[model samples]
Target: MAYTSEENYNPEDYLKDTLNKLDIGFVKVSNDDIILNHNLTFNKIFGYNHEKDLFGTKNLDYWLNSEERNKFREVLFKNGIVKKYITPAKKLDGEMIFLQITFKLNKNSKGEIISSEGIFIDVSERIKTEQKLKESEEKYRVFMETAKLEDLKASLYEKDLLARIFMDNISGFVVLLRPSTREIIAMNNYAKDMGGIPGLTCYSTIGQSENPCPWCLSPKLWKTGEAQHLVVDALDVTWDTYWNPISDNLYLHYGFDVTDQAKREKNLKELNQIKSQLLRRASHELKTPLVSIKGFTDLLLKLKTEEFQSKSLPIVQEIKDGCSRLELLVNDIILASKLESSQIILSKSLENVSELIFSAVKVLKGFSHARKQKILFDLHEEMFTMLDKDRIQEVLTNIISNAIKYTPKNGTIKLKSKTSKGYFVIMIEDNGIGFTSEEEKNIFTQFGKIERYGQGFDVVSEGSGLGLYIAKKILTKHKGAFG
Candidate 1:
């Protein structure tokens, strides 16, 4: 392959070698449109083993269809050259490929065409990439146009074709308006179908107001160049609208009907109001009877006569315990409901954390004694913190009581408290039954509960599943962390 310098080289040999090695397909055809010669690259591209395989093949037959060939010839003949014209071509194997071809007519001295030469570039892969890009762009456009209008901030100018397509395809009212005159410059199919027309003022077409609607956001958009969002009620329907600025002079006014959403919100508010009122009345009605039962049971327990202690004592004691449990359940229900509705307010003050924990433990000591369980604590000496004293007591009571209830008889419950990185942390560990790893995550969710089996006890103290949930909410409101 060694050759002399450029001055001694042959131009024809160099050209033939270069053409054969190029990635492009090179072909020369007679004026009758029959292929006469082709490079190796051309033969490989057309599924031919040799140039002779295409010697008499009609060049026009390579085109996928007669219409495509006719258009290519019409343009090539009128100009004598066609540069990078893209079209589908059929290969010798009958597979279709997209090609970008540049063809030039070779003319003799008499100015008559004698042959045609061209190069073909396989552009199938490029065409596929372009199609994918187009599809992705279409998806993005759809997302932008159909999303809640208030959330959209793109300043789509009128000259952008894709933006135009997006506007045309919108299922709700969309219009571009001239701010000063309120003239509708562009509108989507939905608006047009509703009697909206371009070149008319919005007040005359879509809007029936003598002046701009009081809630119109165009004025703010003109001054701030920021998207304005609002809800307006018209035509017995509520509209959630976005007014975005395309330029200083023009703005996009887009909106969709939100009547159903508005109605749902309204009904929810009314229902919550009714629930609050009913909760208050029910609390009074329910607690009155329990208080009477508890008062009579206490009076009966105070009597120490032989006959009273023998027969009525146990039944009265059971009634008293039932009343106490019912009262606790009622209080929990009320508190949980209030917490969920944000109806409870906290009263915070500087308090001793150790004192709160000890007080809660002492209050529940009788319950642990009944279960034959012991409570052990290793609390910091004097941990002071800002907290709602009553609420934190409630939190401590709930956690300690839960530990007691779940622990087996004769089980030991340990309570530890200390200051960690500016936070007063408390830990309650029981040697009864612990939750699974997955259950721990959702253990505090509203009404989240696990079925309990009474292993070595006479009765299982299953909860209403609101104690920990309420404690978590109270701690959250106080900016305290809980698990």
Candidate 2:
């Protein structure tokens, strides 16, 4: 702590003694491999007898193994303090201690290697903790990405990855560009697939292109930072182009194939239009029979009296049967309404085949009798069917009504039912006008009807042609076999 002069200085030993009083280990060795000085902590940390091992040895080989000894000289010449160089040194007590030696060299005026000193800092615990922390960080990052994506409900990161994967397999021009400036800085596997846009001063493999490529959605992306989409039939191939903006100045674009989706949408619209028209016609069909059945039943119910015992039972039963027919008609209307918006709910049950068929045929017979046409029913009594009974009756009634309404009197209408090939084969054959091939294509479709008619026999003006359509939907709910 007092003033000192160089003439009276004991610099080397004084420095070693000063370092010995501190918390760390220190050592100094000469270029000729002679141990010169060391601190007290060096012996304490290495478990050495300070009195005996302080200057006992200084050969670099005395500390480093064969492999480390070779690298030791090179490191001393290159860098003074070697990094995490592992070595096991024997103490005066014969105990070996693992050491990490890091130190600096004192070079002389000749620019030659002279002597070196080092700080042997133990880092075993710190290195081990760092490895574990790195592993934990990796696991947490994985978990955070998964949970955060679901909570946010939109995978911004995954969207980037998916867009990359989508473009990878696609054979079209793709680009990631700066939106405002329209600088194309990124592209994918098929970047030049479309002969590259030419003549515009945008950054691309083509350098510049005049006309914005048909697939280019940059103009649209400038308006909205989302996937600006366009469908066009160009170059004899339908292309679905998409533009996705990444930032105010960044966007991605690609053209995909959407030919199939376009065709399906067109067909679906046409089919729905046809179905709407058919429902209009089928509603008319239901009301015609419904009005007569209701009118006749009211009159028949009024006619029955206690005095007329012979005819009373038959008349009451007839009225009850007509009421049942009217109930089925009402169910058809419900089915049509639901089917129009595709919202039909079915009440499926274990069906009595004979009962369901007889109930349906009862009304058909009544109609045939009213029209003076002959009809017969032959059904297997013991068979069973899983079905929505109301809807099946709708199918039968539409066909039977069409047959009887079109057939001349004395025409034969047959209702036949039998189990065959794991399904119920219920065929209603009549010697009346049947539909043509063109008409039969969408026969089960809604709003479809026959064109043939007599004077005042307007088929299109009849009940909603939704009968077959509603019937088909009902059968689907029951898992019923359909033709």
Q: What is the TM-score of each candidate against the true structure?
A: 0.49, 0.36
C-alpha lDDT (0 to 100) for residue 460 of candidate 1:
52
Compared to the true structure, candidate 2 yields what TM-score?
Answer: 0.36
Report the C-alpha displacement of residue 458, candidate 1, in angstroms. 9.2
Candidate 1 lDDT, 1-483, residue by residue in tens: 334785665545655665565566888999788999888878777777764467888888788998998898888776667778999998888999998888877766445689989877777765764564355446545754665344223344532333455465454577777776777766777777766777787776664655665335456676677888888887677887778775567677777666765764575465445555455447666899999999988876876535584776788789999999888877887887788778888888999889998999899999899989989889897888788999999999988888888887888999898777888888888886776765575578655554454344443556766789999999999888784
Most TM-score-accurate candidate = 1
Model 1 whole-model lDDT (C-alpha atoms): 0.74
The segments of candidate 2 whose C-alpha lies over 4 angstroms from its true place after superposition are 1-256, 259-334, 455-461
Tens digit per residue, CA lDDT, model 2, 25-92 = 76788877677877777777766576656684755534636566657767766544465576665555
The number of clashing residue pairs in each candidate reads 0, 24
